[model samples]
Target: MPSRSRYDVVIVGGGHNGLVAAAYLAGAGRRVAVLERLDAAGGAAVSGTPFPGVAARLSRFAYLVSLLPRRVVQDLGLRLELRRRPFASYTPTVRDGAPTGLLVGDGEERVRTSFTRLTGDEREYVAWRAFYARTGRLAGRVFPTLTEPLPSRAELRARVADEAVWSAVFERPLGETVEETFADDLVRGVVLTDALIGTFAHAHDPSLAQNRCFLYHVIGQGSGDWDVPVGGMGAVTGALLEAAVAAGAEIATGHEVTGIATDGRGAEVAWRTDAGEGVLGAGTVLVNASPSELARLLGEPGPPAPEGSQLKVNMLLRRLPALRDPAVDPREAFAGTFHVAEGYAELETAYREAAAGRPPTVPPSEVYCHSLTDPTILSPALAADGYHTMTLFGLHTPARLFSGDPADRERTRERLVADALAALDTHLAEPLADCLAVDADGRPCLEVRTPGDLEDELRLPGGHIFHGDLAFPHRAEEGEPADQAERWGVATGHRNVLLCGAGAVRGGGVSGVGGHNAAMAVLGR
Candidate 1:
């Protein structure tokens, strides 16, 4: 079972980030070994058709791509393709029980008109644009620095220079900024939604995790657009997998890295596979698992379980549901992000209920029809059969909700599916369930993945998507270590260990910066 007694590096996980690290190190002629617990790599970035007999492929857990650097693509010689959606998002609003909506993107005039109709004024739209312009400036100055060494606080702030930018984002509660910036409650919520997505935190979280989440959500290569991987997320990961293998990196899936220890000479990785237990000697060990899980394997107490609050539901619709507002065609409406019951107060109410150990009556959620932008996800038979896919992500669904009695948690998640869909159905011309593509067993081609489901399936610490709560990218402010570790911001307390996953600084999303920076640290680049 052992290829050799030791390798130059033994990465503890085979996630995209780990693969990225291995690819780089191996390309530089270092012996690399990647050990993954599962039969497959890709971690959260994978695609599959879960519904039995459903011909349409769904992105499953993690859908879409943003923050993946173009440099990573070119450097690895990956043949991945990212297709941009023409429309950014279409949100339905109701007044007097009449369903109307704001269709953002497609055209500037239509977007402005939608805002005016909803607010009875054009004030909020102008403010929204001004807000982006400011963040745009900040993105320009900071986004480029992600792949390089981390900048100190003073250096970054001096780079930004604008007092308003610091006061609004880096220093204050994001809620105050959102509330102050947008006048209408719905408009404010649309902006605030980015702050809370997948994060079980309020807009006013003093820890500023919400701010960090918001920052990563927008700083997607300075464009802030989440592009659809043409053949689903699998293509992106598959390409990386190919590059890693081609570069002479050894990948062993189903080999769970169970322990790690470091010595003066080198580090050691202990893993369990079907064959038996084996220890791989390495000059350094790269851990791509969540810090909490990594800590456990290192025999240390991980931090208090990180909170993750999102319900992911995958469905195959026979046809796009008709929107109550026909001005925006259903195809155009669902082509981009779609919001449901996510008003500002609505979001707060849901967070309150979930924090109080109850699921919200109306869960704030968003949906994207990936097939709308990339029809390659659908088989010709399915596409001709009028099938499409919708991936819905619900907010304010903490791990605590599913941390209750096992039966109770199951029931709560089930109820959330009903409530979240009901919220979305309110804006549709017909019941969304009516468009379901049924399986041969007569079960609807739909699947729900709760936080509990994630913990069970992926070994994620609390199923937190960014591995842990999102952390600021830079080694800034007080209490940061001073050294080369601070430069890349990927080093661990152990000299020989480094993080190359979502827990690393700037590790959020599918960005390979964490892995790239980790390799740089090892290579002294």
Candidate 2:
């Protein structure tokens, strides 16, 4: 039971976003309460020791910090350190029967040499630099607007002040820009990968879904750099949990919000616990759940099920796997994103196959070794013994492929894992399985999470990470309501109900913008 039956604000879902809202509102002297379904509060932004008795805590679901703003960190006084990676990305490929790779952001001279080796000239390298410089400028101009009220299309375009850059990213399809800017298939793929992360869209998607996804990935805190949290991702949520609790917010876990009834002025939040059912009255209800889930709770027909389009695999390696490209050290290659079978053609082919209801012949994926950047997640002994962690994200593996008869789904999972490893093995000197760290039970220290598994465990409908497709931070091109709540981008059909989760505008990745904007709307800022 809560401290009282009524609260100034009742927040449903204790994900990092919810905690952010709780901390801000509670600190402002508002009576706040956060109800979570799970026993924990972090939601997807959590770390767990997945392998039994492994003594290594892995960032189970979401990894890396990109969109978190400095303002939120300072406002909450959070104790967190985000370390930048020295290398940006490494993509392995073969040219004319010889094995080679391109390493970006390692060093200017080295990157130029690698690009020349792969493309037979310096034109591709020059184009790559010029293209990113354009995005960098766009990031600087647009990222700060995310935490504030929604910007009108015209206002954002004027703020950018560069019609060409704005039109390339916001107006036209992203694939057109990539095709016109760069000629090398591999380089183009690396740039376009940002657009397709967790999104089941092709490069030329007319809806500009890929453009929206790419914008969020590139506009993180005015720098597109994705930093590693010192501790696992849990450190992020831990800091939020601390701030919220210290501010006198009541956090009740294991209480599932079952229903919400609002009548313009106030809202009633009905929840279920192991013991029984209860209701909490709130002058304002902040829903941190997905919009589809919110519709279900409200007894309304939600949109079609959202299908997540990525396969996540977590592995603990006794030692880093050897690379086929001997010039680049394995440490450097794994430090940043390692691109495997992700050339532009490969990505398109995979998308076509997945759209046709078949698994990709060659899975396009990227691997990240967080331990190389932040070793605090590992035990002292593991860190000293050359042990490391790898997170492999395979694109174009939609949830539809994994949802079917139980036996068929199992077979699909096995085949997808094998295909992903095979794609990675093309760039490795030795089999990746050889580097596995076995647990006390003698099982391999690897875990595969499919969309179905995530849906069952995390209550994520169709396992869509951003709750559904991501929306642009600004108001739509058609038009938007001029009301304050509408301008804040947190309004719901009900006057007193607001969205404060990934389903909200400007919500995606691990950013707490949704929560902050919702609080601002409630406070009438």
Candidate 3:
């Protein structure tokens, strides 16, 4: 139980956003307390040693860092090292019965050569550069406003100042724009992957959910580069935990919040531990959980649980697998994202098939080898012996497919994993299974996480990674709310309680924008 019956602020969860809010508020000399249900904090952003007796510590759920703002790091004085990957991405394909692939990296000449080698001309490369140039401009304008009060849709469009770019990205469907810009199927698929990460939607879905997902993927820190957090994702939480504790914020793990009640002025938070139950009064409350969870605590009806749509697989490799194309080295190809079975037509077909209650004919996925970029995550012996780690994310595998009786779910899991691995084997010189590293128990060091697994382990309803459908990082088209807290995109039905998690506007990724905005709202900035 809490030492006292009251506090200046009571946070409902101890995820990274909650820790950030605690650090800011406590540093400002307000009594603050953070309650986490799990034994440790960090939520989805954590690392684990899954394979038995495996020395390699892998980033279990959330892997890379892109949306974390530089201001958060400097303000909290976090000790972190985010290293850039040497390459961008490599996608293997068969052209004219010959093995070939597209490789994108730092050198302009090299990239131009690769494009010319694949497409038999330079037109596609020029269009690729021009298309990203528009998103780059949008990123420069929109990313800076995340910490500020929500901007009206019209206001943000005006700030973008390029009507054509805004229309292509924000108004029209992403598929139409992509089809108009690129001719090559492989090239188009690579661009569309950004829109479909963790999202289940057709290319031309009228709701334009894909466009919102694509926008967040590209606008990180204005440059949109996803970097590896040295020492795995756990290091990020460690830094935040240290900062919050140093600022006098109390962290209470293994304390599950059961209910929250608030009138306009103050609130009471009730929680339970193994020992017993307790209640604490607070002048304010910040919820670092999903909107559905918050509604449960308030005893009110909430929206349907968001359905997650992806498969996460982690593996330890004794040696990197060989690629079909000999020109590109395995190290360079796996350094960044490695695309498989993600052609434009293939992605559309996969989405259509999965939507119709069938497994994807060709599962679209991407893989990354963080060990190539940052080897410190491995033991000294493993690193010296050429061991590497791989993280794979497969798309269009929705949570709905895994539902039914226990035996039915098992059959679904087996089929999906088999199809995904088969799709990957098409581009490799040898089967991926051949490169697996055996653990101390003489078992293959491979772990798979389905959406259902995430829901059970992390309390994520349906295991939706972003908590729910990603909203535009701005106010709605109709108008802005009159309440000050609502204007910051953190307000709930209750006045004293605010949302500080991925459910908040502009809170999709690992960014601390949600926490910062909520703090500003409470401080009446």
Most accurate candidate by lDDT? 2
Q: How does residue 361 of candidate 1 score in lDDT?
A: 90
Give the residue spans of candidate 2 off by over 4 A: 477-482
Best-to-worst order by lDDT is: 2, 3, 1
Worst 10 residues of 1 by lDDT: 476-485
Report clash pairs, candidate 3.
none
Whole-model Cα lDDT of every candidate shown, in order: 0.86, 0.91, 0.90
Worst 10 residues of 3 by lDDT: 476-485
lDDT by residue for model 3 (1-525), tens: 456789989998888899888888888888999999999989888888998888999999999999988988999999988999999999999999988999999698999999998999999999999998889989999988888888988888888899998998899999999999999999999999999998998789999999999999999889888999999998888899999999999999999999999987989999999999899899999999999999999999998889989899999999999989988999999998999999999999999999998878788999999999999999999999999999999999999889999899889888888889898888889999999999999999988988899888887778788888799887885486777678888988888999998889888778878887787788873
Pick the winner on TM-score between candidates 1 and 3: 3
Writing each residue's lDDT as its tens digit, candidate 1 over 1-525 gives 448879988898888899899899999999999999999998888899787777777887889888888888889899899999989988888866777777789788988998888888889889988898888888877787888888777777787789998877788989999987887888888888889888988889888878988888887877688899999988888998999999999999999888998873598889898889999999988899888987888898887888777899999999989988867798988888898988899999998999898899999999989998899999998898888999899999988888768788778878999999999998899999999989878999889998778888888778788888887666656454555555788877787888988888888788888888888888883
- Candidate 1 yields a Cα-based lDDT of 0.86
Q: Which stretches of candidate 1 lie over 4 Å from their true place?
A: 477-483
